[model samples]
Target: MNAAEVVKSLLVQRFGIPSAHLNAETPLRSLRLDSLALEELRVLLEEQLDIDLEEVSLTPRNTVGQLVAAVDGVAA
Candidate 1:
Protein backbone atom coordinates (compact mmCIF):
# COMPACT_ATOMS: atom_id res chain seq x y z
CA MET A 1 0.00 0.00 0.00
CA ASN A 2 1.06 3.55 -0.63
CA ALA A 3 1.26 6.18 2.10
CA ALA A 4 -2.41 7.14 1.90
CA GLU A 5 -3.55 3.55 1.89
CA VAL A 6 -1.22 2.62 4.71
CA VAL A 7 -2.38 5.60 6.73
CA LYS A 8 -6.06 4.86 6.24
CA SER A 9 -5.45 1.21 7.03
CA LEU A 10 -3.69 2.02 10.28
CA LEU A 11 -6.41 4.44 11.30
CA VAL A 12 -9.12 1.93 10.59
CA GLN A 13 -7.45 -1.15 12.07
CA ARG A 14 -5.43 0.18 14.97
CA PHE A 15 -7.46 3.22 15.89
CA GLY A 16 -10.83 1.58 15.41
CA ILE A 17 -11.92 4.25 12.98
CA PRO A 18 -14.75 3.52 10.65
CA SER A 19 -13.47 3.52 7.10
CA ALA A 20 -16.64 5.10 5.79
CA HIS A 21 -16.04 8.19 7.87
CA LEU A 22 -12.58 8.84 6.49
CA ASN A 23 -11.88 11.42 3.83
CA ALA A 24 -9.14 13.79 2.82
CA GLU A 25 -10.80 16.82 4.33
CA THR A 26 -11.57 15.15 7.67
CA PRO A 27 -9.57 16.59 10.54
CA LEU A 28 -7.79 14.35 13.03
CA ARG A 29 -9.79 15.78 15.88
CA SER A 30 -12.99 14.91 14.05
CA LEU A 31 -11.80 11.36 14.21
CA ARG A 32 -11.27 11.79 17.95
CA LEU A 33 -7.49 11.43 17.76
CA ASP A 34 -6.11 12.96 20.89
CA SER A 35 -2.48 14.02 21.39
CA LEU A 36 -1.47 10.62 22.73
CA ALA A 37 -3.16 8.85 19.85
CA LEU A 38 -1.46 11.19 17.43
CA GLU A 39 1.91 10.24 18.88
CA GLU A 40 1.08 6.57 18.65
CA LEU A 41 -0.03 7.09 15.06
CA ARG A 42 3.24 8.80 14.31
CA VAL A 43 5.13 5.79 15.59
CA LEU A 44 2.94 3.39 13.67
CA LEU A 45 3.26 5.38 10.45
CA GLU A 46 7.01 5.61 10.79
CA GLU A 47 7.23 1.86 11.34
CA GLN A 48 4.86 0.85 8.56
CA LEU A 49 6.08 3.41 6.05
CA ASP A 50 9.71 3.17 7.16
CA ILE A 51 10.11 6.90 7.06
CA ASP A 52 11.01 9.43 9.73
CA LEU A 53 8.33 11.92 10.73
CA GLU A 54 10.52 14.01 13.02
CA GLU A 55 10.33 17.06 10.78
CA VAL A 56 6.61 16.87 10.26
CA SER A 57 4.50 19.01 12.53
CA LEU A 58 1.43 17.07 13.46
CA THR A 59 -1.58 18.43 15.28
CA PRO A 60 -5.10 17.20 15.80
CA ARG A 61 -6.28 20.11 13.69
CA ASN A 62 -4.48 18.77 10.65
CA THR A 63 -6.54 17.07 7.99
CA VAL A 64 -6.14 13.50 6.84
CA GLY A 65 -4.95 14.89 3.51
CA GLN A 66 -2.37 16.97 5.33
CA LEU A 67 -1.05 13.97 7.20
CA VAL A 68 -0.84 11.97 3.98
CA ALA A 69 0.99 14.79 2.28
CA ALA A 70 3.47 14.98 5.13
CA VAL A 71 4.14 11.26 4.94
CA ASP A 72 4.45 11.47 1.17
CA GLY A 73 6.91 14.29 1.62
CA VAL A 74 9.11 12.22 3.90
CA ALA A 75 8.71 9.13 1.78
CA ALA A 76 9.65 11.05 -1.32
Candidate 2:
Protein backbone atom coordinates (compact mmCIF):
# COMPACT_ATOMS: atom_id res chain seq x y z
CA MET A 1 0.00 0.00 0.00
CA ASN A 2 1.00 3.59 -0.53
CA ALA A 3 1.61 6.17 2.17
CA ALA A 4 -2.00 7.32 2.30
CA GLU A 5 -3.32 3.79 2.52
CA VAL A 6 -0.73 2.90 5.12
CA VAL A 7 -1.71 5.87 7.24
CA LYS A 8 -5.44 5.19 6.95
CA SER A 9 -5.03 1.52 7.74
CA LEU A 10 -2.84 2.22 10.74
CA LEU A 11 -5.34 4.73 12.11
CA VAL A 12 -8.11 2.18 11.75
CA GLN A 13 -6.41 -1.00 12.94
CA ARG A 14 -3.95 0.31 15.49
CA PHE A 15 -5.97 3.24 16.78
CA GLY A 16 -9.40 1.65 16.59
CA ILE A 17 -10.80 4.39 14.36
CA PRO A 18 -13.64 3.52 12.09
CA SER A 19 -12.50 3.25 8.48
CA ALA A 20 -15.54 5.08 7.21
CA HIS A 21 -14.85 7.96 9.55
CA LEU A 22 -11.47 8.67 8.02
CA ASN A 23 -10.95 11.27 5.36
CA ALA A 24 -8.31 13.69 4.23
CA GLU A 25 -9.87 16.56 6.12
CA THR A 26 -10.22 14.69 9.40
CA PRO A 27 -8.19 16.28 12.13
CA LEU A 28 -5.88 14.16 14.26
CA ARG A 29 -7.22 15.86 17.36
CA SER A 30 -10.72 14.84 16.34
CA LEU A 31 -9.58 11.27 16.71
CA ARG A 32 -8.55 12.05 20.29
CA LEU A 33 -4.89 11.33 19.61
CA ASP A 34 -2.60 12.86 22.12
CA SER A 35 1.08 13.63 21.67
CA LEU A 36 2.05 10.19 22.94
CA ALA A 37 -0.28 8.55 20.50
CA LEU A 38 1.12 10.63 17.69
CA GLU A 39 4.60 9.55 18.68
CA GLU A 40 3.60 5.93 18.54
CA LEU A 41 2.06 6.60 15.16
CA ARG A 42 5.35 8.05 14.02
CA VAL A 43 7.18 4.92 15.01
CA LEU A 44 4.64 2.73 13.27
CA LEU A 45 4.80 4.91 10.16
CA GLU A 46 8.56 4.67 10.13
CA GLU A 47 8.41 0.91 10.34
CA GLN A 48 5.72 0.56 7.71
CA LEU A 49 6.92 3.20 5.26
CA ASP A 50 10.61 2.68 5.97
CA ILE A 51 11.14 6.41 6.22
CA ASP A 52 12.32 8.89 8.82
CA LEU A 53 9.87 11.51 10.12
CA GLU A 54 12.17 13.20 12.59
CA GLU A 55 12.10 16.32 10.45
CA VAL A 56 8.37 16.22 10.05
CA SER A 57 6.42 18.06 12.66
CA LEU A 58 3.48 16.13 14.06
CA THR A 59 0.66 17.73 16.00
CA PRO A 60 -2.82 16.69 16.98
CA ARG A 61 -4.04 19.76 15.10
CA ASN A 62 -2.69 18.43 11.87
CA THR A 63 -5.20 16.89 9.51
CA VAL A 64 -5.02 13.38 8.11
CA GLY A 65 -4.14 14.88 4.72
CA GLN A 66 -1.18 16.57 6.32
CA LEU A 67 -0.05 13.31 7.83
CA VAL A 68 -0.32 11.55 4.52
CA ALA A 69 1.65 14.30 2.80
CA ALA A 70 4.33 14.15 5.44
CA VAL A 71 4.69 10.42 5.06
CA ASP A 72 4.60 10.62 1.30
CA GLY A 73 7.17 13.38 1.39
CA VAL A 74 9.65 11.25 3.27
CA ALA A 75 8.75 7.98 1.57
CA ALA A 76 9.34 9.54 -1.81
Candidate 3:
Protein backbone atom coordinates (compact mmCIF):
# COMPACT_ATOMS: atom_id res chain seq x y z
CA MET A 1 0.00 0.00 0.00
CA ASN A 2 1.01 3.61 -0.50
CA ALA A 3 1.87 5.83 2.48
CA ALA A 4 -1.62 7.35 2.61
CA GLU A 5 -3.31 3.95 2.50
CA VAL A 6 -0.95 2.62 5.12
CA VAL A 7 -1.72 5.58 7.39
CA LYS A 8 -5.47 5.15 6.88
CA SER A 9 -5.27 1.44 7.60
CA LEU A 10 -3.29 2.08 10.74
CA LEU A 11 -5.84 4.59 11.97
CA VAL A 12 -8.66 2.14 11.36
CA GLN A 13 -7.06 -1.08 12.53
CA ARG A 14 -4.94 0.20 15.38
CA PHE A 15 -6.91 3.16 16.63
CA GLY A 16 -10.46 1.89 16.04
CA ILE A 17 -11.30 4.91 13.87
CA PRO A 18 -14.12 4.50 11.40
CA SER A 19 -12.96 4.46 7.81
CA ALA A 20 -15.74 6.87 6.89
CA HIS A 21 -14.14 9.58 9.02
CA LEU A 22 -10.73 9.23 7.52
CA ASN A 23 -9.39 11.33 4.67
CA ALA A 24 -6.09 12.81 3.61
CA GLU A 25 -7.03 16.22 4.95
CA THR A 26 -8.24 14.88 8.30
CA PRO A 27 -6.37 16.05 11.37
CA LEU A 28 -5.02 13.25 13.53
CA ARG A 29 -6.47 14.78 16.69
CA SER A 30 -9.98 14.25 15.31
CA LEU A 31 -9.49 10.57 16.06
CA ARG A 32 -8.96 11.34 19.75
CA LEU A 33 -5.45 9.99 19.73
CA ASP A 34 -3.63 10.83 22.89
CA SER A 35 0.10 11.35 23.07
CA LEU A 36 0.74 7.69 23.85
CA ALA A 37 -1.34 6.59 20.94
CA LEU A 38 0.43 9.06 18.72
CA GLU A 39 3.75 7.67 19.89
CA GLU A 40 2.58 4.17 19.14
CA LEU A 41 1.57 5.34 15.71
CA ARG A 42 5.00 6.80 15.22
CA VAL A 43 6.60 3.51 16.10
CA LEU A 44 4.23 1.61 13.85
CA LEU A 45 4.87 3.96 10.96
CA GLU A 46 8.59 3.69 11.46
CA GLU A 47 8.41 -0.06 11.48
CA GLN A 48 5.99 -0.37 8.59
CA LEU A 49 7.51 2.30 6.39
CA ASP A 50 11.13 1.79 7.44
CA ILE A 51 11.53 5.47 8.22
CA ASP A 52 12.55 7.20 11.41
CA LEU A 53 9.94 9.71 12.51
CA GLU A 54 11.88 11.05 15.46
CA GLU A 55 12.85 14.11 13.48
CA VAL A 56 9.69 14.43 11.44
CA SER A 57 8.00 17.13 13.56
CA LEU A 58 4.66 15.39 13.76
CA THR A 59 1.88 16.98 15.78
CA PRO A 60 -1.81 16.54 16.57
CA ARG A 61 -2.59 19.30 14.09
CA ASN A 62 -0.91 17.44 11.28
CA THR A 63 -3.14 16.00 8.57
CA VAL A 64 -3.09 12.46 7.28
CA GLY A 65 -1.66 13.74 4.00
CA GLN A 66 1.11 15.51 5.91
CA LEU A 67 1.97 12.38 7.79
CA VAL A 68 2.08 10.41 4.58
CA ALA A 69 4.23 13.08 3.01
CA ALA A 70 6.63 13.00 5.93
CA VAL A 71 6.98 9.26 5.59
CA ASP A 72 7.42 9.62 1.85
CA GLY A 73 10.01 12.32 2.39
CA VAL A 74 12.08 10.12 4.69
CA ALA A 75 11.68 7.09 2.45
CA ALA A 76 12.87 9.08 -0.54
The most accurate candidate by TM-score is: 1
**Better lDDT candidate (1, 3):** 1
Alpha-carbon shift of residue 31 in model 2 (angstroms): 0.5
Checking candidate 1 for backbone clashes, the offending pairs are: none
lDDT of 2 by residue, 17-45 (tens): 99888899999999999999999999999
TM-score of 1: 0.97
Candidate order, TM-score descending: 1, 2, 3
User: Rank by lDDT, descending?
Assistant: 1, 2, 3
Residue 8 lDDT (model 3): 87
Candidate 1 Cα lDDT to native: 0.95
Write out the backbone clash pairs for model 3: none
Each prediction's total of clashing residue pairs, residues at least 3 apart in sequence or on different chains, is 0, 0, 0
Estimate candidate 1's RMSD in Å. 0.5
lDDT (C-alpha, whole model) for all candidates: 0.95, 0.94, 0.87
Question: Tens-digit lDDT track for model 3 on 20-59?
Answer: 9988888988878767888999999999988888998878
TM-score of 2: 0.97
- Lowest summed lDDT across 10 adjacent residues in model 1 is found at 48-57
